[model samples]
Target: MSLVRSAGLQKFRQSVEALGGDPEVYARRAGLPVDALDSDELLVEDSALAAVLEIAAADLGCPDLGLRVGRAQDFGMLGPLAVAIQHSPSVADALACTSRYMFVHARDLSVALVEDPDGSHGVVGLRYSFSAGKRPLPQATDMTMLFLHRAVEFLVGGRYGLRSVDLPHQPAAPRSRYEDAFGARVRFGRDAALLRVPSSLLSRPLDGVDETLRRLALAFLSQQSSEARPLVTAKVRTVLDQSLGTGSTELVDVARALAVHPRTLQRQLAAEGESFASVLDSVRRARARTYLTTTDMPLSQVSDLIGFAEQGVLSRCAQRWWGRTPSALRQEARSRARPRA
Candidate 1:
């Protein structure tokens, strides 16, 4: 439902190859073409990128794949967004660049800075949100957190300053794995995903601020943004993910929540070469695969969570999504997660 730059997929390829594994084999298992490496210009479907990273992590037996990939990346890979941020005068300006122009690089995901109202200290942090809910990027959250720290440090080098971090999901490994990787205290099951730092550091200047490129990047970004269509499909997917199991995944309800007429929303989707039912089905399939492969919940519960009428309807949908039964997918997930003796 959203377009993702193939940078994540590219980095995964590099990581897999470093492990002496064939990246194409892993990618094909996740329904992506080996030719994904052919063009850095190519964009991938958001759910496909998630599936690829999730499966690749399992195949290579690297539970910390996202963190590893994020560690290796620099800002140059971030496309136009990187260009805009690299010349910013301060960390705050860089974050503002991300908040405004991140959509140019990645869809469905948003990044922003927020000051901590509760903290006595000068606490501010970056927060991440998924346009299609938490289900969209199950494996990418850690990567994004690491990227945030690295991108800022690429400007003002220091302790990679972070006060604390929180994630919405449970940990896949031991607490030490996270704390060691992040160099910060980490907590899970948080209401949101955030990485907090001192508000005073926000004004720290970059190493080499370029006045000329900054103005040029701003001009290009402004032009691209004006012509850019609002991510109506992304919003629709988000609403549908939240609405499922609550009441209806109906178009009218989603449109109303977005504060637009249903037909107007349909027109926007049409411009983007999407439809309401297609977006709903995309979110449902992504959630189904994620829940099936990650959690041990029964198929009946999965059905209810994704708003399927019953297990039978879910069975048909699962078969279409993964070419296997829900049980088979779960079994495969568990098998891949098992440690080799």
Candidate 2:
């Protein structure tokens, strides 16, 4: 009964259509929500996705369909999780973040760094698996493994020293296809989906690491993780933060971002003793405080950044929230930051 984010199916429709099959037909036959295909906002049953993938592979006679789909997808499919991983200091840290928060993508999927199967020194194993019951999911497994390899490739900006790939199920595609996908030797009928890498590569640093963006992205993912069991308010606040400057902070827009109906979003917020306007104002106030204190940006620019239409509006809000003008607040912040003489 575990759910997977539909982003996992990023190229599903086009991939199916390219193979001359109706994507909707495959989805419906497998009990999948047809509308959720290739979407990021909705969750689908993991088993249903596995079923559709197997069905498509069988009908299209394309055993490597999963690999194709996986190959086409990039880190952007991961949304904020990608941002967090990309900014990680090292490849190992990125993998660790993925392993810890992958439930934000799929509840029953596991990605871990493990010991090499052959007890080989100076080698490490990266394993990927789905807990989708006894039913064989060669296609989904292939796709996910290829995805993991590609993700690491993106992180390290190249091949990542892959030595071999091992899968639990027999090759759905030709052995060469799997090997080609990973650019390494492919072994079938093994214990799990594992990629062997030189242990040294584990410590390789990622380029363009940004501590601030990484912290923000990790905070967002942590809030979205199942362990957080986040309330509707948190979700709404997150959507607001992303959409604030875009002039789309309406209830409908936030609800759409969350894949929920407006009324449903409102009702959930009300159940928690909140409302959309109140949340929006709270977000604005917090953002205002951060901008006024941290940077010397002009009031007009700060107004736009926080979703207000004019500087006058920001001035009024500053008065309401802190009983002072935005300029006065910024001056006070500057004074506090100054060294005492």
Error of 2 at 243 (Å): 32
Q: Which stretches in model 2 have alpha-carbon errors above 4 Å?
A: 132-136, 227-341
TM-score of each: 0.64, 0.68
Candidate no. 1 TM-score:
0.64
Tens-place lDDT per residue, model 2, 81-179, is: 899999999988998999988887777788899999989999999988766444348888888888888888888888778989988888777888888
Clashes of 1: 0
Write model 1 residue lDDT over 48-128, tens digit each, in one string: 777776887777787788787778776787776687798998888988887888776776678887766346477886788
Q: Please report the candidate that would top TM-score against the real structure.
A: 2
| CA lDDT, candidate 2, residue 294 | 70
Q: Which run of 10 residues does model 1 get worst, by summed lDDT?
A: 33-42
Alpha-carbon lDDT of model 1: 0.75
Query: Which is the leading candidate under lDDT?
Result: 2
